[model samples]
Each structure stands twice: as structure tokens, then as C-alpha cells.
Target: MRYLKVIAQDRSGKGVADTLHVEFYEGDQLQRKATEADRQRLKSFSKTYLKCAWFNSGEGEDRHVRIFSHNPSADGTPETVRLHFHEGPVIAYKAAAHDLDNDGVFELILSSDVDNDGRADRTDRNRVRSLVREFLRVGW
Candidate 1:
């Protein structure tokens, strides 16, 4: 499996300069710089989703994509969306939320990963369309 790191910040009158950084990796080694097309795709996605702070995958054996969003409040925690993939199809979707009750721990809300028939769930595919289409264009 491969990994990609995408850095994007909100620039919608937030007094922040727009910037994008993309890098691809195979294993622990950097493969190469992102192409112009890859940068464009990330830019377009970031434009549509201004809350996106950054997105990347875990190192080594992790085969998932994590998208981190900006926090709305200064004292609030940011949300993270994870797309778990097996082979190529996205098998699970998970969202981590801030602690609403002022607890020290955060909360993780999971979408159903399996149906009654024990098959991988694809219902959340639409929710992570950008990752599937732009990054991993397989098993769609």
C-alpha cells in the first residue's frame, strides 16, 4: 500500500494565505513529489471543503486515510474522519468528535462496518468520495 500527505488551510477571508502541500510515499521512503495534477485536485477539494486542515495516512502497515478538519471554536477540538480500506474498497468509516461534556477523552462514532451477512460496508462511500476518486482510484 502507498501513503499520501496533503496539507491545506482555509483561506476564505480568514486572513490566512492559501497553501497546499502534497507528497507521496511508498513504505517509509519518499517516492517523489506530487505532480501538478495532484496539486490541482487537492486545491479544488480544499476549496470546496474549507474546513480541511490536512489529510494523511498512517505509516508502515496502516492502510487507512485520515482527514483532519479545523475546529470551529478556539477552545474546541477538531474533528477527524477516517476511511478504512481493505485491498482497494473502503470497508469502514469512522468519525472522531470533540468532548462535548468537558471530558478529557474524545468520542469516536463509527458507521456500521458490516451488514447482517458479514460483508464489508460500502454505504459510506459517498461520504469519502474525494479520497477514493482522487487518491485511491480502485475498487470503486
Candidate 2:
């Protein structure tokens, strides 16, 4: 009974705008793609992708999140796998209300950078500085 929170990021690790554009990942094994429909479907998937990530009493690497095992050979049994979510930092910029699990309203996520390299260590201060410079430019 978990839902997902969608987070979009640019290569420089910035949030995406609300217009619902998408970035696709593909390989040579792929051929002519059907991305228009795929893009629409992706939004639905991304929104709930992180909902399964939850921690118990404490936080950090010790906390593990269970994911759908997708193990189907069903004689009617539940299958799941747990992964150390702390290993990868999550960047959450927004939240929304849901009655999905009846968990009462909004679900959330916090920012962390366990390794602090690829993860976004840059903060609002950096963004503010950049915007100021962009606005004060001498030439159009």
C-alpha cells in the first residue's frame, strides 16, 4: 500500500520544471522507439517509484527499503527484496497528498548525500547566486 513521489533531475542535478518533459535512456539493443506514449506512462511510474522507500525508527545506511520482487510463479506467496537506500542519496523537492494507503495524507522524503560526490551537495545559496548573476547581466 505504498505510492511514489516523482523527482526529476537534470544532468547538473537541478529540478525539472512542471511542464512534464522527459529524458529517456536507451541503448543500441533498442530500435525505433515509441516515446510519446512511453513518456506519458513514465510520469505515472515515476510518481510512485519512491513510495516504496520507507525507513523504520532511525535513518541512514542501517535503514533498508523493501521493493517488489516481481517473482511470479505464484502458488500464492509474497516475495520482496530489501536494499540499503542510504547507499544512494535521495533528492526530494516536493510532496503531494494521497489517500492510497490511508496513511492519512502526504508522504515525504529528506535530502542526504552519503558519499557526497554525484549527489547534489549544492544548496539554495548556489542557486540564488546564479540567478542573481543571470538577472544582472550587462547585455541582453
Candidate that scores best on lDDT: 1
Question: Which digits, one per residue and each the tens of the lDDT, describe model 1 over residues 34-55?
Answer: 6776655565554432232222
Instruction: Give the candidate number with the greatest TM-score.
Output: 1
How far is each candidate from the true structure, as Cα RMSD in Å? Answer: 16.9, 16.4
* Candidate 2 lDDT, 1-140, residue by residue in tens: 22111222232323322222222213213222335755554544434332323222222233322121111334332222111232235522221112233332212222333222344444422332222222122111
Give the runs in model 2 whose Cα sits over 4 Å from its true position: 1-9, 12-34, 50-68, 75-78, 81-140
RMSD of 1: 16.9
Instruction: For each candidate, give its TM-score against the true structure.
Output: 0.37, 0.24
Instruction: Write out the backbone clash pairs for model 1.
Output: none
